[model samples]
Target: MQWDGISEFVYVAENESFTRASKKMAISTAQVSRQVSALEKRLNIKLFYRTTRKVSLTEEGRVFYQHCRSVLDGLDAAEHAITNLHSKPQGKIKLTAPVTYGEQQVLPLVNNFISQYSDIEVSAYLSNRNIDLVDEGYDLAIRLGKLSDSTMMAKKLGKRTSYVCASPRYLEKHGVPHALSELSQHSCLLGTLDYWHFSELEREKSIRVSGRLRYNSGFSLTDAALKGLGIVQLPDYYVEQHIKNGELISLLDSYRAPDEGIWAVYPQNRHLSPKIRLLVDYLAEKLR
Candidate 1:
């Protein structure tokens, strides 16, 4: 029988995490993952139930793990943790993200990751609806803002700031709003939400805003603001450069809401495969 991945498998079984097992054995998580995967392949049986959030043994995997642990009672544990760093990560990773962010930011990062790991394949679905990972068989999802209380695990990839802005031409014609209350007097470009979010005196606040035009698209709303049609509130990604070049003027600086997290969320007990885990880390690093 092949002995290549037994130690790695044992460690992962015990710790329920490739990352934790790697640290305990002083090896790369990639090595731990690769070994376990290799062991499963050699045995022609699945070893672990994998999810990005956690890992657990399957029935056959449990039996194998138990057998390995007993055999290890008479063997050196370190001897089982073999070094195999030559294997390139290769697998399919299915994920979902919000439409605009996926198009503008996340998919680009995924492209870079695929460029590095040519053997890995990915399928990304961009939608605003909250997809059930386990039910729909999605491996992971990118979510924005505050996460609701849930059993699912999440990692903050980065933060996004929202800006309330209007074209200088609009501000000049209508007079700039100096206080939150003044927003009522100006036409506000609308999006999916009828209210704009902000912070006032250290407390979160939302103010209802109405406009001559309402569209679900950020680009459309931004265009309306640039054309001096009205003011708009949107995440910085949509307006930061425009503000920088003086196409739009930031409003109520003191009332701007705190930045919200961009997150990578996955189902519990469904541990991320090595390839997906690698992508998550790459996304986190690049996003940071």
Candidate 2:
């Protein structure tokens, strides 16, 4: 089987235009058409449905394209690994993390990493949304809490615990809740999640919370809590310093859930890049 035909076919499928594919592959239009035709003839199937205006993949073409894409991805990974085998970590690393954590922790570490490895560049996207690492072309991501994607590889960076807290003024105005059930009596400043984490006799629990003011940002929720609007459940990074400064008082300590693991997640590619591996290690060490 000729590899050129497969490459041409994939490129054509992606662009949906023979001319565009030819340009992208730096080959003539005749060459691109010849290779794709050769592939279809060899496979004994129609790969594309062509009209005067556009090209569309046939059902068979779509199936073939999926397999071809995976093959091309593997080939690219192999080439990347081979090229960087002995080289210092160089090139751009695209990473994503939750906005608050990125600004508070990951950004500083990434700054330090670039300072140490002068050849490497970093691009970070701080978002609360769970980004598709492969589709988004990200090298790695820093994920907090539990990981649900079994397909990705995760390295534990450290642990973060949730803090249920309120300002002294709020506690004084509204008597502190003594137990989980008592949370219903006091207004709870809700964050993005619908439930607040807790622990009961070694078992993790999530209690549904409500508030007069609901916010998606931890900073906003903490600020609301500071102004005595309501109680808030937040990660330690947002509330720890305030707890020390007597701006916020930790509540329901006995029911505080087990610490959640912070992870550096990446695609489970066969050849993980050195830049990603080393950065994950650096973050783990610094966070620990």
Candidate 3:
């Protein structure tokens, strides 16, 4: 059987829908159906039990699927190895990160890297939603906070310290909060993480703070705080320039927020491309 047929079969089995498999493979649905049919004809057995709503593998199909998936995976590894041997890194590298961080931080570094390496092409997806790197064929991702994905390798770039702050005008109007308990009396601008934590003395403490406005985007909340709407807790990178310019002021100096780490993550099994490795190292150096 053609290797292409085997690959298509594996995709179909994993997705359980010819239409979905076709989209992923970048082929027509009819082509996917025909390849599976031809494979079934050659094997002289039904591979899939198909209904109008769903498709499931038959007994023979289950055994064939395991072997097909292994073969396809091995073929991908071989291709990556062959590409790496050519000396120059050349190919598309797909990456993802949070919207604001990707725009303000990752894009500049990516531009510098792309300028130096003309052969390497890069595509970046900026969203907060967690992406499946292997399943979606992404080369790598930049993630913040704690990582729980055991299947991927995480290279931590550095840690970002968060600050609680507000504009001088807002502080003058509402008065500065002397302690964590007094936050309830102020008009706080909350972000995705509602519960704030701080390192006091030798221990870390956390408290859930509510506000009149809650925003999903850190950029939005920072903007509100800049306009003297309310106090906001945000990363240092997001507010450092503003604070320096006297547009915002830091508060609760004695209590330090827990530091969040940034990481470069990729699937564990795939060969690390020279281009991706260089970019990751470059970012770690620049961010540090």
Candidate 4:
């Protein structure tokens, strides 16, 4: 209800110095001091304990500061909402994703999104490691597979199906794997992971695999598979086109693992800004 001295009082309380608050507000120190004094008189409360060296909040001031800070934050949010309503979604959003998927799938869509909303900018970090969006100050993150962080709020952007496949030349030369056990007989192009996932009788399974070519890169593994170096188990993005073109043959369809969820996750504790929310919706629509 009382707005006259609230801003100046809050500024001084938060900064714990009238001079600093004056500088922040672009006002004179005497004005800052007068406003806060008037606020204390109007409220009939001692808000600050001042000394020659330091100034700090009193018990009443601490309580007032808590509520005042929330009010200011709410006002900021309201202002942002009004601005977004009047204009197109425009802001920088920083996000993270696994390297291969971001490069092959997510980043291209992000490019398309930025083209549509030219005022918006995106900073995407492509990495395999799980990033703490809140701790790292990222607006969003695209993650794959079964999610382990129950604390994160996620939207299912899409699904990624893994394919167990080999080039026609490799299949012809090394013989096709008719059963899960037959994978051991052929040369397997390896990635960072040594285990190939599968599903058998409604149960998920991870079979340990080994090979001569090992790279943390999915593109390299796909190239190795195309060159007929060995069979590979990779996400469909890496091999689906090749399978459709008959350059690579999909194998073990009967035991293929269930499609893993591709998710866009943000800290559950954080607010979803309009730009980020729109971006998430846009991605889900395109991915679908």
Candidate 5:
């Protein structure tokens, strides 16, 4: 089967107009019509019912359209793989990540990676809001949570634990909460969610924590916690060095928060591009 002809037929069927399909395919309208006609002749089927106003697919055309789509998709994948072999994975790779994670963890590695692979260009966006990878044309994203999209592929890089922490000054004044239930008694810095999820003695738990101070940004919440204002539940990355330095002490050690795993995610593709694969592997190795 002529893959080019089949591809042209699929485009025409999708557009329902030879002129529109030709514009999309960057070919002459006459060439588009010729290719579709050639494909129909080869298949020995009437692929479309043409009219003055518009074109509609015949019964045989619907079946041929499905087959053409599959065949053309396979051909495109094959061509991309072959082209990738000759290419040195040189292109702009757009990535999205949480602000704190991107700034503290990913930024350092990106600098090193770019230095090593001078050909690869990277653009990293640090934002907490979920982005539409396909719509935005992002090559990859580092996501930290449960993935809800079945359309994308994700590789687990590592697991992260949260810590309920407060400054020594706050602990000295307000005292510490020995039990998870006691968290409500103390002032707390809240994030987007008013409740904190945790686990204790093999059982899961949730605590409704309130605070005088609240912020949507994690950095702001961390700063509030550092100022000895109230207790805050935050990821280990934000508080680890502080915990080590005794700037912030972990409270309620017996109760563990729900762990969130870091993942490198990308839109599902027939063949993974070398650039994305390399970066994902590099992150997994570095984080692990």
Candidate 6:
């Protein structure tokens, strides 16, 4: 079969609108319509049910779309492999990470990666929100805790340990919590999550914690703890130095939760690009 307008047909089918597909593919709406018309004529089928404001694909169109998408994806993988063979890592690698971790850990490594591989460019988005890597076209993402989305492939860069800490003054005034249950009597400073993680009798445990103050930023929660507002649970990186400086005290050592993984996640594709693979490796080494 002729493949002249197959790409346009695929785009329209996926997007469910010629106008939106045209905008995405940077073509005119009329051109997109023309290409789809040509494709339908060649295939000799009614592909779409057009309406005044919407378009719906026919059953036959849906089946054809799946095959076309697979073919295009294969072609893209082959192109990526062929074009980048024996070539230096070059092209923009779009990445995302949590704001605190990105600022404290990932950003420095990313900068060094770019320094070493000058040909590889990076665009990083730092936020706490869960980003859809495939839909957003991210090359990779630095994710903390457990991997929830099974669709993405992940490499463990390192582990992050949560610390229950309080300022020396706060502990002195409110008394230290020797056991997990004692937390209920003490004022707690909370982050984004309402529960805190711990371990009991060699098994994982979670306790619902409440606080007068709650914020999304780890830095803010640590700050509140420092001012003797309440006890807070934060990652080791955020409070280790303070604990060492005798400004904060680490408590509940026996009950500290199992270390959670720090991961570099990317979509599962047939071909993983060298730039992404190398970057993940670099982060794993640097973080370890």
User: TM per model?
Assistant: 0.71, 0.71, 0.70, 0.72, 0.73, 0.73
TM-score (C-alpha) between model 2 and the true structure: 0.71
Q: Stretches of candidate 6 above 4 Å error?
A: 1-85
Per-candidate clash tally: 6, 0, 0, 0, 0, 0
lDDT of 3 by residue, 4-51 (tens): 467678778877899989998899999999989988988889999999
How accurate locally, in lDDT, is each candidate?
Answer: 0.88, 0.89, 0.87, 0.88, 0.84, 0.88
Judged by lDDT relative to the true structure, which candidate is superior, 1 or 3?
1
Per-model RMSD to reference: 10.9, 5.5, 5.8, 8.2, 5.8, 4.8
| Model 2 Cα lDDT, one tens digit per residue, 74-119 | 9988898788888888778999999989999999989998899988
Model 4 Cα RMSD, 1 decimal? 8.2
Model 2, position 41: C-alpha lDDT score = 89
> Which digits, one per residue and each the tens of the lDDT, describe model 1 over residues 176-219?
99999999999999998889999999999999988889999999
lDDT of 6 by residue, 1-288 (tens): 677787888778766789878986898999999988988898899889999898888999889987887787788788988888888887889999999899999999899889999888899999888898866878888999988997677889999888999998998888989988999998899877889999999999999988799998788888999999999999988999999999999999999999999999887542468888889999999998
Model 2: residues with Cα > 4 Å off, grouped in runs: 1-86
lDDT of 5 at 260: 88
Please give the distance, in angstroms, between residue 35's alpha carbon in candidate 3 and its true position after superposition.
Answer: 25
- Pairs of residues clashing in candidate 6: none
Worst 10 residues of 6 by lDDT: 267-276
**Displacement of the residue 85 alpha carbon in candidate 5, Å:** 3.4
- Candidate 3 clashes between residue pairs 3 or more apart in a chain or in different chains: none
Better of 3 and 6 by TM-score: 6
Residue 114 of model 3: what lDDT? Answer: 94
Residue 206 lDDT (model 6): 94
